[model samples]
Target: MKRERDHQFECGICGAEDRYLLHNVRHRTPSYRRLCTNCLLKDHRGLFCPFCFSVYEEPLPIDRSMCNKCPSISHKPCIPSNYPHHTPFICPSCSSPNFSFFNPTTNGDSPSGRIIDRDSARALVAAAKIAAVSMTKAAAMAKVEAEKRVKEATYAKKRAREALERLAYLAAKEKEIMEGKGGGSNYNGLYLAPPPPPPPQITGKVEK
Candidate 1:
């Protein structure tokens, strides 16, 4: 018996395995290749489809649109057919108030009014990631600074309390010294009379 080979697929762009097969229609002879969902969407050069959360290379006959306010792109097939139509579509990603289909304007303007190419979008995402990291670092630095300030403040308060206690102790000591001097004594610049001279020596115990 012959063993059958398992058909395994991998995406050429992202090196993902077991992906969907996509047919390239650009060539005169159509060729098929496997593409992961991520690669497929990335090729579309837009945000994920709001309805399917998938990416597409181009707006197909099925339906496709872009949000004017954000990078969100959508496919009509992913949404209910009865979805209420609005003049400008609201972006489900960023919820931008403006939106439109990915179709060229009557004046031959480019499709998807926004001029974000795949490379540009990648750059933007990279920049955003860097900005986020910077912001996080700044916040951490700020927190550290705040903590340092708090510690310094606490130390200062402790010093102030200690100084006040020392002043109080000195005041108490001075008061005690003053009270001690109240008694008649030659202490603290005060003088007191000596005891009366010894009684006249009993000179002669004279005539008993």
Candidate 2:
């Protein structure tokens, strides 16, 4: 145990890094995470014997043991016989059939329960907000892309219609020239007349 105390570790509650003794405050996990002096004295003051329902005093290290599932503490006499005597121990409250993971306490209002509940709730809310923001941005981008594709399609259709109209106009003019319907030669869709037979020869100016 003394060798374990030499290592620098972070407190389970406040996240302060320092050399401290180990305690199992974190829920669900069987392993014991480290706890600082401030957390043991300040936050975990309610740690008491679940069987006797009495708080342990100073010099409690000899008789007291922490639960592997939660921050619960127990005395030698309060400890159950079936429970194995080892580094990891489970208190009676945790071993009960009505045990709950989120609410680790009997009354659901314990100090550790409140911390876990509040943190879990805040995390869920933050995740929801981020997801909503991402979805909104994606929808907006999709709408813009859809509009751009529609505009491109409309422009392409208009260009195709204009090309068809130009082809129809040239075809009509070519047919007219080929059949001699214009009564003269047509140069590049332009019609020319025969020049009116040279204006009656215009001999010696006009007559009288």
Best by lDDT: 2
User: Tens digit of lDDT per residue, candidate 2, span 23-87?
Assistant: 33433322334554334333442344554545444656576777787777777776667765666
TM-score of 1: 0.36
**In candidate 1, what are the lDDT values of residues 1-208, reduced to their tens digit?**
1211122355546554442233121111123333443344444335355555443334433556666655656776666676656557654434432432221224336553345545434433433333344356566666897999999999999999999999999878766765665534545655465466776665556675
Q: List the residue pairs that clash in candidate 2.
A: none
User: RMSD, each candidate, Å?
Assistant: 19.1, 20.9
Superposed Cα deviation of residue 77, candidate 1 (Å): 38
lDDT per prediction? 0.50, 0.55
Which ranges in model 2 have alpha carbons more than 4 Å from their true place? 1-116, 181-208
At residue 178, give the lDDT of candidate 1. 57
Give per-candidate clash totals.
1, 0
TM agreement with the true structure for every prediction: 0.36, 0.33
